[model samples]
Target: MLAQNVKKLIDDKAMDLNSQGDLADYVSKKITILNDYIEGKRELSEPNVDDILSEIVGFFTTSLDIPLEEGTKFLRARTYKVNHLEVNVPKLSYIPLDLSELATLGRLNKEKEPVYYGCIYFEEKGGVNVAFSESNAEVSDNVNILRSTAKCDVNVNYVGIYDYVHRQCKPRFMPQSMFEYFEAVSKYQEEKFSESVFLAHLLCDAFLSDILRRKKSGNLYRVTSILFSIYTESSDIDGIMYTSVKSEGDPVVALKTESVNSKLVHKSCDNYRIINDYGYAKYHAIHTHYGSISGNSVSWLKKNT
Candidate 1:
């Protein structure tokens, strides 16, 4: 279904020579990478999965131009009142530290569990990305089915497949571009699309539950799922985004950064892992930052992940 979705996205769009060629090139690159991972000719290692999830999430929110302030809620109520999903979240127990925080970080600590952040539904699996944000890529004329476009140039295969496969759901609340906002978010009943689409179901479940709970409780606020904290040298700004969490506890957390020539070597985005000593973290894949509590960061870290 996903591959077909990619193909149709190719077929329907009306593009000029340059844009069409660029899109074709982009889709081809993704397909080649996906094929290798699917066939095991090459695998998206534990870290790579993190990278892909980041990109996937990026496609939905940032690259698609969906702002971090905008939260993805379920179209409707959930059928399965599954609350222990955190316990069942997908895991990669030994992904090495560098891959855990990010594929680029290059730290390797295999002694601990590699963290994984995805879920499986209806036999399909999906995960959120660690670094999915508009800042990572510039976006324009983002197209997803719910929104309508008379003529525009931005395109990606994910948006194409969603437009066709999830055609039933009207495009609601699109980025500044003209898209119809669904009066109420749609809901999936108890049936599944395919194993590949199961993760969407899980997301639907989690998001709906969150939206409903917030509606009732009122103190709840949904943060962007892909959380990040970054500072660019030219900008001289410290920015942070929290994912689906309301962490009002810590007022000040240390930034363990190094000064490289006049630049800073700071941690971009890493999930806090178990701390070894002196507030330094010993993490495997997907673990980076940890908070010190009760006079010890180690004990607190162990209980969190």
Candidate 2:
């Protein structure tokens, strides 16, 4: 009976989602200025850009259904220092960067906006390699730089940039029913929301554009940053999961600091080093450490070789 009931529930959800009511009509009505702007048919009026962005934010926040009840686990890496050869373990502060010290724009974060970033598995490589790749770590001959990465478990409810674009890798958290509904809505030519939804897709492409390269402050950062701020500000979305430009489409999640503080948990942190030779790179792990957080800092407790 339980198995039959589960099947019935799944079937009912499929049927209900298939019968989407007025979604295309509503989106078409909301994104008039943005649709015109993307089609190259007209120039945006003085305040039209702002209005269009508002519409985009509204559409994503309301139209997309994000399931964040289940927490997703990923690894976050940061440069680790051991007292220049003094300390023997890593601290809790090593888990994430201090937002108060933020000096530049990220692909999805404005300066001082606390977003905890993590990477998932990519091909044969695990989340650790993807995390280090996302770090843009450099290889130096004279200097030894160590990195510490932690496994972060949290409910990272996110918006994605993978569905409509060609990517080297697709994240596991990619939304299923919501995007298909948009695709169906985009095919409704009689309602003409097709063009509108398509324009919105172009905006999403910008979010993953090669121009907005990782770790560099591109000129378009302001625009993309605004889009991010607006999309995350009014919603319960804890993170924005997008493809990492430096990692060949590896998935990266940028979680809100508040969310990290409240929901993130990890059992251990691993220390490692990256060695670069000419054009090739190698990684070596040295130890794993455990610790706890206090007031605005962390203290390392123990370590294992």
Candidate 3:
């Protein structure tokens, strides 16, 4: 019964891939080879099993244009106990990407970003279950079932046990804000100073807001002031030099209190005031705000944090 059900699952998957024309022949041949081994007509070596798995993973990555590393993570195998029988199931989660905005960005300059959708897949003892959720839903579930298979008492050796279910997912790495900030830097390198400055301002606002939230002080004014003070003081030659030199005072206290203007009033006013005060001049103007945070400041933050 298990063998028949597994064959049906493979046939369904092969039918889906076969619809893609050129991939049809390849899928048919591989499925036949796997079925031969499963039926005991031929022996399946570990390398042969790996090759089949690679071909399966390649189908997804090639079709979706996703990186191989990211695509392979979706294919998994595990053993589960059901009615005292151990069942091994493999699953695949496919995520579709909206390259429309990315294509538009390639053609013209724009601030709009691409969107991504979410998809989840779970393979039961004999069937597959799928679910859809928001784009922000966590999809990278790195559950390694193969590693835990040893704990199972039943040693089922059917090749069909490695069969997987594919259901159409959603997407990370660097922080989006930092990515935009680096993009602005690239723009600056291209001599698009105006666009760079605009992006820099956006990044600056985001950075300050992030700090405020992380601190959770409820006093945006004080938080912004402290960050601005840290930036400006770090920019000074003496301050930069003294950072490396051991100081008499507590480094944390000095970082918080030093060079911050306590008298500055108004939240919105202080926000831009800190930006401009840090030397982020207008178009074609030198003394960039990016220069305000010195290497010493970064080192200090890294050490303290």
The C-alpha lDDT values of all candidates are 0.22, 0.46, 0.23
Instruction: Find the 10 residues in a row with the least total lDDT in model 2.
Output: 140-149
**Residue runs of model 2 more than 4 Å from their true location after superposition:** 1-52, 59-65, 68-71, 80-103, 121-125, 140-217, 277-305
Point out where model 1 deviates above 4 Å. 1-22, 43-62, 67-166, 170-305
Q: Write the per-residue lDDT of candidate 3 for residues 1-305, one digit (tens) a residue.
A: 12344345434544454345444345546556654554456676645644663554333211101111111111121111221111211111111123333322210011132111111112321110111111111222211111111111211111110111010000122235433433433333224223333233233323322332232222222222222223223233111001001111101111111111221111100000011111111111111111112211211111121
Ranking by lDDT: 2, 3, 1
Model 3, residue 67: distance off in Å is 17
lDDT comparing candidate 1 with the true structure: 0.22
User: What's the ranking of the predictions by TM-score, best on top?
Assistant: 2, 1, 3
The TM-score values for the models, in the order shown, are: 0.22, 0.58, 0.17
Clashes of 1: 17
lDDT of 2: 0.46
The candidate 1 region of ten consecutive residues with least summed lDDT is 141-150
Q: How much RMSD separates candidate 3 from the native structure?
A: 30.1
What's model 3's TM-score?
0.17
